[model samples]
Target chain A: MQTMVETRNLRKTYSRPDGSTIEAVKGVNLEIQQGEIFSLLGPNGAGKTTTISMISGLVEPTEGDATIGGFSITKQSMEAKRLMGFVPQEIALYPELSARQNLAFFGRMYGMGGKALRRRVDELLEFVDLADRQNDRIDTFSGGMKRRVNIAAGLLNSPPLVYMDEPTVGIDPQNRRRVLDTVKLLRDEHNMTVLYTTHLMEEAQELSDRVAIMDHGEIIAMGTQDELTQQVGEEDRLEFTIGAQEIAEAVFERIQGETPGVTRILFNPPEQLDEDSSVFAPALLTVFAKRGRTALPQILQELDSAGVEIQSVAVREPDLEAVFLALTGRALRD
Target chain B: MRSILTIILNDLQIFFSQRGNLPGLLVIPVLLTLVVGWSIGQIGGGGPTRLRVDLIDLDQSGMSAQLIEDLRAANDTLVLCPLDNDAEDFCRLDDEPLPLERAIERARTGRTSALIVIPAGYATALENFERVVIDYYSLSDPLQPGLVLQSLNAVLQRASTASMIPGVAGALLDNVISAAQLPPLEGETRDGFLRALYLRSQQLLTERPSPVSFRVADSDGSSGSVLDNGFSQSAPGMGSLYVMFTVLGGMSVLLRERRQWTLQRLMALPITRAQILGAKIGVYFTLGIVQYAIVFAVGAAVGMEFGSSPIAFLAVMAAFVLCITALTFALAPWIKSEGQANGLVLLLSLSLAPLGGAWWPLEIVPEFMQTIGHISPVAWAMDAFHDLILYNGGFRDVLPEVGVLLATAAVLFAVGIRGFRYE
Candidate 1:
C-alpha cells in the first residue's frame, strides 16, 4: 500500500497577548496509507485539531512539515490541497446559501466548473441523501442535514484523501451512525484514504484501521485494537459504582495488595461527573486485573469493610477505553 | 481569477437570498433621497426665488440705466428695488431723497441680498475715456459670495467691457490723428464721431449674446427650476451615506463567517489566501457599487444631474466604496463579537455620514468644521459628486477628489490586508 499522507515532527505553538506561548501540538508524526481509515483518538484539547489543521494546511506549523501524496503542505499547498478534501468540525457552509449553491461554490474552488461541477454536486447531494433539500438554505435544514451537506462539500472534488474532523459531533445517534457508515463507505467502496479525528473511543474503535491515541499534545500509543489491548497484558477491567463518600487511598492500596491477579486501580470521584444532572452519579472505581471477575468480590469486600456503600458493579473485557486508561492512568472521559 | 469571481457571485447570491438586506440596500436609500431632495427643494421655494438687489445709480446716465437693465437680464432671479430713481434723486438733490446710507442700511439689515452704487461720474469719465470706480456694497461674505452678488458681478463685467472698449478705441483714434500731425478736428466734429462709434459699439454688444448666460432648466420635470431642487445633492449624499452603511455591515458578517468557520474552510481549499482576501473585498465593493447604482437610478428617474463626466462619477463611486470596504476589513479582525461589530457599524455610519456633509452641503458648515469634515472619505466623495452634479464639471475637475479617495483607500487596504485574520 502507498502512503497517502505523512507528517514529520509537526508542531504548532500559539502566542498569547501577554507574550506567553503554548505548544498545542508537540512533534506529531503520522503516516496514513491509501484506502484506509486512520483515527486520531483523544479527548478534547489533546492536539488532535492542531495536528489536523497543520496537515490540512489551515494553520502554519511553527516547526516541521506534512505532505499529502508527497506534496509538501507548506510549500506546494495548492497542489497538496487539491489532492484532499477537508471537512471542518464546524458546519462551515454559508447558512443563507442553498446546499447546491454551497457545493457548487466549493466545487469551483477546487477547479471544477460548469456541468461537471453541477453533476458532481448533484451526485454528492444524492449520496448524502439530501437531494430533496438541495435547494433549501442550509440555515433552514436540521443539524444532521447541514452536516451531510458539509461532508458533501468535501467530496465535491472526488479526492482520494479526506480529512473529517469530528464529523459526527452534535448530531443525533442515528445521524452519527449514518456518518460512520458513510465514512466506512468512502474507504470500502470509493478506495479513499480518511483521517478521522474524534474524542469518542467507540467511534475510533469502530471506524479506524489503525488508531493513534493522543494525550497532552503527544501520541502515546499507535496500533490496531488487539495490539493496543495486548499492551495492558490481557487484563480485564472491573468497575465499581459507589455512593458519593470519601474513601481513603489506603483502601485501594489494600485491595491491590490483597487481590491475587489485580494489576492496578483508578478512582473517579463524583465531582468529576456531569454537574447538570439532577441524579447524582456514583463514584467510580476501576480495577485492572487478570481475570477481574475473580477479583471483583474481593474488591467489593475491601470497599465494604472501608464503609463504602456499593451501588453497582460491572466487569468488562479490554477495549480502547481500557487501553487508554491503562496507558494514561486515567479514564478516557476524564 | 475565476475563483475570485465565484466567491463574489456566491456572496452576492447569499446576500440577495436574505430578505433582511433589502431595506438597507435599496428601499431606505431611495426613499431618503426622494424625501430629502424634495424637502430641500421646498426650502428654496421650489422655483428660483428672486434675489432682492438694491441699486443706487448716482450717475443716472443712459450708461448706468443700461448697466441696471443688463443686471436684470443677466439673472431673471434678481429683483432690483426703487423703480423710479432719476439723476436728481440718485444725486441726492430731490425733495425726498433715498440716500446711499439708507440703501446700505437696507442691505446690512438683510432687506436686500446686495446693493450696487454707481458713483456720480455723470457720464463725463467714460466720455473722456478715463477710469471710474463704482462703489459696490453688500453684507455677503467674500468667502461665500451670495447668488445675487454673483449675478451682479456678471452683469458688471459685461458693462465694463462694453464701455471700456469704445472709450479705448476713441482715445487711440484721437492720439493717432494728433501724432500724425493731421489737422485737429474741433469740438462738435470730434464729439459727433466719438458718439457714433460709442452707439455702434453698444449696439453690437447688445446684439451679441451675453458672454455668460444662466440656463436654469426644470430638471425635476416639474414647473420649478432645477437650481432650487436638491436631488443633485441628495442623490450622491444619501447614496454615499448608505454605501457606508451597507459596506461597513460586512464587519459583522465577516466575524460571523469566522465564528462559523466558513472562512477557515475556504482557507482549506486549493486557493491562495490572497485570492480569498481579494474575493472577500470584491464582494463588499460590488455590493457598495450596487447600492450606489440603485440610489442613483432613483435619482435619474426623479431628474438629478450626473454632470458632464460619467466616467468621473463612476470613479468617485468606486473609490469611496473601496475605501469603506477597506475600513470594514481593517476593523473586522479586532471585533470580538457580532454585537460589537453591529454597534460599531451603526456608530461609524451615523457619525461619519452626517459629519461628512451627507445630510447637507459642507458649504453650510463653518470653515473649521469643513476642514474637519474632509477627514471622512464621504466628504471627498461628496465633494467630487457636487463638482459633477452642481457645477456640471468634467473629469479634470473631480480628479483631486478622486485622488484623495483612492490614496485613502490604498492606505486602508494596506492596513486591512496586513492585519486581516484568516482564522
Candidate 2:
C-alpha cells in the first residue's frame, strides 16, 4: 500500500507569558497507509489534538515536519491542505448561516464554484441526512445534527485523505454509532485514508485497522489489536467488582499462592465519595491466570470465606485494556 | 482573489442578516444627519442666519429712530433685536423689557453681537453744532472688527458727516454775504434749508452700500451664496463619525470569529493567510463605504454640492474607509473578549470623531484646536471633503489629504498584519 501521511520527528512547543515553554507534541513519527483507518487513542491532553493540528497545517511544528501525500506541511502548505480535509473537534460552522450556506461558502474556499459546487454541496447534505433541514440555521440545530453537517463540510472536496478530530464528541449514542459507521464507510466504500483521534479505547478497538496509543506526548504502543495484546503474554484476566469493604492483602496473596494457574493478582479500591453521601464507586479486583475459567470457582470460594462482598464477577480474555494495564501498571482510563 | 471575494461576501451577508445592526447603520445616522444639518441654519435652509444686536434708543427722538433705520440699512446680516414687528420675539427674549445694563452685558458676553445707545438730545446737539458721543459696547476684536462693529462705525461716521455739513455750509454762507455786501437771510429760513440738506445727505449715505456690505465667496470663485443647507457639513461630518462606528465594530466581530473557531477553520483552508486577512479588511471597508453612501445620498437630496471632481470625492471616501478599517484590524488582536472589543470600539469612535471635528466645522474652533484635530484621521478626511464640497476644488487640490489618509492606512496595515491573530 502507498503511504498517505507521514511525519519525521514532528514536534510542537508553546511559550507561556513568563518565558516558560511547554512541549505539546514531542518528536513524534507516524505513517498511515492509503485506504485504511488509523486511530490515535489517548486520554485528554495527551497531544492527540496537537499532532492532528500540526498535520492539518493549522499550527506550525516547532522542531520537525509532516507531509501530506509527500507535500511538506510547512513549505507546501497550500498543496498539502488541498490534498486532505480537516474536521476540527469544535463546531466550526457559522451559526447564523444556514447549513447550505455554510457548506457552499467552504466549498468556494476550496476553489470549487458554479453549478459543480452547488451540486456537491447538495450531495453532501443528502448524505448527512440533513437535506430537509439544510435551510435552517446551524444555531437552531441539535448537537448531533451540527456534528453531521460538520462532517459533511470536511467531505466536500472528497480528497484521498480525511482527518477527523473527535467528531462524535458531545453527541448521543445513536449519533456516535452513525459516525463510527461513516468512518468505516469512508475506508470500505470510498477507499479513502482516514486519521481519526479519540480518547475512547472502545472506539479505537472497534474502528481502527491499526492503533497508536499515546501518553504524555509520546506513542507508548502501536499495532493491530492482536499484535498489541500479544506483548502482555497469554493470560486470561479475571475481574471482580467488589463493594466498599476492603479485601485483606492476605486474601490477595492466598489467591495467587493457592489457586492453580493464577499468575498475578491486582486490586483497585473505589474512589472516595463525599462525606455526606452513602454511595461510593465500586472497587475492582483483577486476577490474571493461565487458565482463568478453571480458577474462577476457586477464587469465588476464597472471597466468600474471607467476608468480602462481591457485587459482580466476570471472566475475560487478554485485550487492549489488559495490555495497557500490564505494560504501564495503569488502566486505560488512567 | 476568488477566495477573498467569497469570504467577504459571506461575512457581509452575515452582518446584514442581523436585525440589531440596522439602527446603527441606517436609521440613527440618517436622522442625526438631518437634525444636525437643519440646526446649522447658515447656507441654504431658507432660514437666514443673522447677527443679533440689541439697541437701546434712550433718546426715543426722531433722530434716534432715524439712526436706528440707518444701522439696519448699513448691514443686512445684522438682525437688530426687538424690532417694531418682532411679535414672535425673534431675539429669543421672552416678553421682558431690555435694560441698558442687560444689553451691555449681552454684548460683553457675546450673547448678542453689540449694543448701541442713542443718547438723549442727539438732534438738539447736532442742530446746535455741538459735539456728541454715541456709546457702542461689544466683544469684537479691536484690530479686526466684525460686521456689527464695522456697520456701527460706518453709520456713526455718516452721522458725523451729516452733522458737520450744516455748520460748514453756514460759515460759507456768512462769508459770501459779507463779501458781496448783501443782507443775511432769515434764521428760520436758513435753519429749514439746513435741516432738509441734512436729511438728504443721510438718505444718500444709507442708500449706498455700507463698508461691510460685501458678500463672502470661495477662493475657487464659486458663488459663496451657493445654496446648500447645512447638509454639506452634516452629511460628511456624520458620515465620517458613523463610518468609524461601523468599521471599528469589526473588532468585536473578529473576536467573535476567533471565539467561535471559524477563523481557525478558515486558516485551515487551502487559501493563504493574506487572502483571509484581505477578505476581512474588505468586509469592513465595504461597510464603511455603505455608511458613507447613505449620508451622501441624503446630502444630495438636500442639494448639497459635491465639488468639481466626483472622483476626488470617491478617493477621499475610499482612503478614509481604508484607514479606519486598518485601525480596526490593528486593534483587534489585543481584544480579549467581546465586551472589551465593544468598549474599545465606542471609546475610539467617540473620541476620534469629535476630536477631528465631525460634529461641527474645525474652522469655528481655535487655531490650536484645528492643529490638534489633525491627530484624528477624520480631520484629514473632513479637510478633503471640505475642499471638494465647499471650495469646488478638483482632485489635485485634495491629493495631499488623501495621501495622508492612505499613508496612515499603510502604517496601520503593517502593524495589523504583523499582530493579527488567526487562532
Candidate 3:
C-alpha cells in the first residue's frame, strides 16, 4: 500500500535566452504504488524528463515536492538517491571500462562491496544477457550490446525503485525488445517499482500497468487502459446506407429518434456516392433489407423518391487509439 | 568514506589501466625532476660566460706593456679584446643587440652576449700614477655592471701593482745608495749594484701591488643578458619551480573527477562532499611531501648541502606544497575542461617558477622585479628554502614564509571549494 514514488503539485520553470520563462513541468501530482510498473507518455519536450529528474533528485523543482521510497528528494537527497536507481536519457557508463568494471564502479558508488558486490554485478549482467561481453570494454560493444550493459549497470545495486528515462533510445529492434523484456523480468522477479518515461504510446500501452499522458508540462490524462479507453466509452456505432437528396429530412429525423444505439449519424446523399447507380430504388431496397430494417419501408420509399444511392453500411467498436484521439484531439503520433 | 575510497581506487585503476596514460604521468614527473634538476645548476656549459671591460693604456710606456702582460696573467678567464672589437661576443652571438628592434631581429636572426670597449689614454694615465679609465660597454644598468666591474678591477689592480713594484724598487735603491754617499766604484761594483737593484726591484714588485682603475659604461643596456648574472647560483632555485607543476597535477585530477561525474556519484553515497575533498587534499599533501623528500635527498647526494637543521628544509617544502595546493584549488572554478586545466597548470606553474625565484634568486633581479616576486607563493617558498639550504637558517627564519603560504592556501582552498561542481 506504500507509495513508492509521489509528487505533490510539482513545477519547474527554466529561463530562456530571450528572458522568457518556459514552464517545463507544471502542477504534476501522482502516486505510484510499490512494485508497480508505471509508464509516463509524452511528446518531445513535454516535461517527461523534467519530472523524472525532479523525482530522481538530479534537478530541483522550482516549486512543490517529490519523494522516492518515502524520503523527500530535496530534503533527504542522499537517502532518496540511495533508494532509487536512475538510468539517465544518455548512457553515463564510462566507455573505457569493461562491463564488469563499469558495473563494479557504479555498484561501489552505492556502497556495495566485497563478494556481495561481485554477486550483484554478476546477477545483473546475466539478467541483461551480456554475460559473454562482461569482460569487454563498452567502447568495443555494438549499440545494442552497450545498451544492455547500460541497463545492467543501473541494476548493479538492486534498488527497489528504478527510473529509466527512454532506456531503449537509439538501439536496434532486437536490443529494444531485449531491454523491454529485461525491464519486465526485473519487475516480476524482484518486485521492484519502476517509473518509466517514453514518448512511444505503444510501449507505454504494452508495459505500463497505468499510464500518465503528459503534454505541454501537464498530465492530460492518467488511468489504466480500460479506464482511459472508457473516457471515449464503448459506444455502439451504427452506420446506415440511406439513399436521399431532398425528401429524407423527416425520415432521417424519425430514424434518429427511433434508434437508441446510434452514437453517430452520417447521411451522404445518393448523388454524392461515386457509383454506377442510376438505379437508386433497387440499391435502397437491398440496403434496407440487408440492415434488417425492412419494416421501415417509409425510409426506403423516401430514399427512392430522393434518388439517393446506397453503397455500404457498417458499425465498429471504439478502440484505445480512438479514445486517445478523442481526448487529445490530435493523432497520438502527431 | 568507503565510497570516496572506491572513487579514488577506481580513479587510480583507470589512471594505470592505460599503458599510455600511466607512462605519460610517470614520465612527466621523472623527466621534470631529472631534466630540470640536471639543467638547473648548469651555467653556460655549452660555452663561456663573458665579462665586458674597456682597456685604456694611459702609461703607453714600456712599463704599461709589462702591466698589460701582468693583467693578462692574473686572470686568464678575462678575454682582453682591443677597443675596436665589440666585447659583446655573448650578446652578438645571441643575435640580440641593445635596441628592441635589433635585439628582436638578432634574437630572431643571430647569436651574441655583451659588448666591451676601451677608452683612449687608459695606459698613459696609469704610467703617470693617475687612475686609468677603461670603459665597459654593456646594455645592462648599474647593479650588474657595477658588480662585474668591481670584481674585474680587483683582478686588474693586482696585476698593475705587481708590474710597478720592480721599477719603483730600482728608483728607491738608487736614492738609497746616493743618500749613503757611496763612492763610484769599478766594473765589479757597477755589476754588483745592477744585480742588487734588479733583485731588490723583483722582491719589491712581488711584495706590494697598486690598485687598477676600471670604468663601466653609464648607459643602461637594454640587452637583458646583463641581468643573467646568477645562473651558477640560481640552479637550485630553478629546481624549486617544478614543485608547483607536480602539485598542479593533483588539481588536474580533481578536475577530471568532476568532469567524469565520479564526484556526483560519490556524493550520492553516505559520504559528504567535504570528506571527499579532504581526502584528495590529504593525498596530494602526502604526494608533495614525498616528492620534496626525494628531490632534497637527491640534491644532497649531488653536493647540495642543507642548513644545520633538516627540519627547517622540510618545513619550507611543506609550506610550498600547501601553497601550491591552495592555488590549484583556486584555479578549479576557472578551468572548465581537462585540457584547459592541464594547459593552465603548465602555463601558470612554469611562468611562476621563474618569477618566484625558482629559476633565479630575487637578489639578482631588478628592484621592481624583486618586489613583484613577493606576490608569488613560489617566491616566498624559495626565499624560505634559500634560508634553510644556503644560509643554514633554522625554523625561525622560515616562519614568515610558512605563515604567508598557509594564509594563501587557506584563502584559495575556501574559494576552490566554493566554486567546485560535481558536473
Q: Against the true structure, what is each candidate's TM-score?
A: 0.80, 0.74, 0.61
- The sequence of per-residue lDDT tens digits that candidate 3 reaches over residues A1-334 is 7889999999999888799999999999989999889988877788998898778765678999998888898888778877877676666667678999999888877777899999998888888878888999887999888778777766776789988888888998888998898888878989998999998877887788888888889998888877876786666333345444333466556544554433333443345334765554311221111233433454444455556554554443444444555566544554
Q: Write the per-residue lDDT of candidate 2 for residues A54-124, one digit (tens) a residue.
A: 99988889989999999999999999999898888999999999999999999999999999999999999
Q: What's the number of clashes in each of the models?
A: 0, 0, 38
lDDT of each: 0.84, 0.85, 0.63
lDDT order of candidates, top first: 2, 1, 3
**Residue pairs whose backbone atoms clash in candidate 1:** none
From the highest DockQ down, the ranking of the candidates is 1, 2, 3
**Model 3 / residue B238 / CA error / Å:** 7.3
Candidate 2 yields a Cα-based lDDT of 0.85
| Winner on lDDT (2 vs 3) | 2
Q: How do the residues B1-423 of candidate 1 rate in per-residue lDDT, one tens digit apiece?
A: 999998899889889978999999988999999988887665542322345567888898988888787777777766676653344222122244457887787566444556788888836776556677876677658777666667667877776666677678777887988899888777988778877777777788778877865533334445344433477778888999899999999998988888999999999999999999999999999999999999999989887768667898899999999999989988988899989998999999999988898888776678789789999998999878876665445576678888998888898889999999886
> Considering summed lDDT, which 10 consecutive residues are worst modelled in model 3 chain B?
B106-115
Ten contiguous residues minimizing lDDT sum, candidate 2 chain B: B214-223
| Highest TM-score model number | 1
In candidate 1, how many clashes are counted? 0
Task: Evaluate every candidate with DockQ and list the scores.
Answer: 0.68, 0.61, 0.21
* DockQ, computed on Cα atoms, for candidate 2: 0.61
Cα error of candidate 1 at position A5, Å: 0.8
True contacts kept of each: 0.87, 0.75, 0.25
Worst 10 residues of 1 chain A by lDDT: A272-281
